[model samples]
Target: MKKKINPSREWYVLYVKSRHERKIEALLKENNIETFLPLVKTVREWSDRKKIIESPLFPSYLFVKIDFRKESEKVLAIRGFCFFVRFGTEFAKIQEHEINSIKLLMEIDASMEVENNHIQPQVGELRKIEIGALGGLGCEIIKVNNENKIIVRIDSINQNILATIPSSYLTQLATV
Candidate 1:
C-alpha cells in the first residue's frame, strides 16, 4: 500500500543513534528533507580556557517533516540511515506541541516570564511547559528564562535526550 500523507504535514521525531543527530540531519538536508534542530549556545570552560559552543536543545533526536509511501524504497532507506524511534514496528510520532514549544523557545532570546504553564517573552508565548520541572514536577519555579539559557538542561550525549537539573536551578528571586 502506498503511504499517504497530506500537505501541511506536521513534524516527526526519528530515533537516530546517539551522537548521530547532527549528521543524520545533515544527510537528510542533503537529500532535501526539511528538518529542525533546536539548539542553544553555552560557554563551556576548562582549566585551560573557555569556549562557546552551540548545542542541540534536544539531544539524540531531530525533527523531520516528509510524506513517505509505505512501500517506497526511499522510506526504508531513510530508516536504514539510523535507528528509527519505534512503537513495536512503527516509527513513533513525536507530539506536535513539544516541537512547537522548542521552536517557540528558540525564537526568544531575552527575559521571559513564567506563570502557570506559560512562558512569556518579548516575542510571544511559546508552548506551555506542561511537564517536567517547569510544570510536571510541581516545584516552585526557580526562574523563567535565565539569560537565554535552557537550564535544567538536557544532555545531547545520549539518544534519550533526558533533562538534567542544574546544580543552581532557576528560582524566581524577584519580580518587575
Candidate 2:
C-alpha cells in the first residue's frame, strides 16, 4: 500500500485539454493543489493591437505537486484534467530540478529545440560551458529550436542536448 502522508507532495504532470491549461491550473490552485504551467512569452495580435502572451511550451500539459497515491481519486475526478501522467501502475515523479529550471526559465527570454534542430546563439551572449563530470569541456548554445534540444558542440562532436551536464551543476567557462 502506498504510504499516506499529510502533505505527501511530489511533482507530477497532468494532461489537460489544450487551451484549457490555464483554466485547469487556476481551478486546481483554488482547490489548494499547487500547480505549475510552463510557458513561453510570445506576441498575439488582436484587431487593433498586438499583445504579448504567455503560452504553454508543452501543449495540454501542466505540472503539479500533490500526494497522488493518497489523493489520486480526487485529481482524476477533476473536470478537464485529462489524467495524471503515468507509467503502468505508478505515477511518475517530475524531476525537482526540472521544476527549478522551469521557474528560473520563466523569468528570462528562452528558446527550445527538437524538430528544427538548430541553435544560433547571439555573438556576445554565446556561452561556452565546461560542464558535467567531463571535468572541463566547451559547448556553444545558439538558437532554441522547436525540439527543446540545446545544440551543443563538444570537442567537434555536434550534439543535440549536451549528454553530460546537469543543468544545476554549471560553472561558467572562462573566456580565453
Candidate 3:
C-alpha cells in the first residue's frame, strides 16, 4: 500500500540560504506554493548617503503553508532551499495565531527590534499589554539600560521581539 499523505495544510518554517529569502519566496510562488516572508524597513547609511531598504525580519528564514507530507520533495528541490526548521526529529509547526500576531505587529508599524537566539534565562514578571497597539499580547519585562522593555517571545522560532512600552500599559499576570 502507498503511504498516506496528509491533505490538510499547515504552516512550517523553512531555512534557506543566506540573503536568499526573497528569491525563495518568488520561486515558491511560481510553483503555486503559499509563502510568507515578513519584511521590515530600516535606514542604512552608506559612505556616501543613507537610504531606506526593506530586509527580511528573520534572516535566512521564511514561512510556508503546505501539507509537508505531500510537498516535501518539491519544496526541498528548489534552489536555495536548505531544510525545514525542526524540533528534535519532528518538523516545527507554526501556529496560525502566532503568524497573525506578527502580521498585526507589522500592520501597526510598531517600532520593533528582533533578537535572534534569545535563549537567555527568563527574567522579570510576565505581563500583558493592556493599552495601545500592542494591547492583548503577553510579554516579559526586562531591564535594558535601567529602563523597562517588553519582550514578546515567539518560542517556536526562538526569537524575541523587543519593544519599549510604557509602564502603565503593562499589567502583571497572576501566577497560578
Candidate 3: tens digits of C-alpha lDDT, residues 60-107: 989998988898788998988999999899797777777887877777
User: Local distance difference test, per candidate?
Assistant: 0.50, 0.59, 0.79
In the range 1-176, model 2's lDDT, one tens digit per residue, is 98455556878778898799999998887787778887777799989999988888667878888877776676776788888766667665665655664465566544322232233444233354443333233444443332222334322111122322233323455677
Relative to the unseen true structure, what is the C-alpha lDDT of residue 58 in candidate 1, on a scale of 0 to 100? Answer: 66
Tell me the TM-score of each prediction against the true structure: 0.54, 0.59, 0.81
Best by TM-score: 3
Q: Which candidate is the best by lDDT?
A: 3
Backbone collisions counted per model: 7, 12, 0
Flag regions of model 2 displaced more than 4 Å.
1-7, 45-49, 111-176
- Name the TM-score of candidate 2: 0.59
**Residue 37 error for model 2, in Å?**
0.8
TM-score of 3: 0.81
Instruction: Give per-residue lDDT, candidate 1, residue 80.
Output: 31
- How many clashes (backbone atoms < 3 Å, residues ≥3 apart in a chain or on different chains) does model 1 have? 7
Clashes of 3: 0
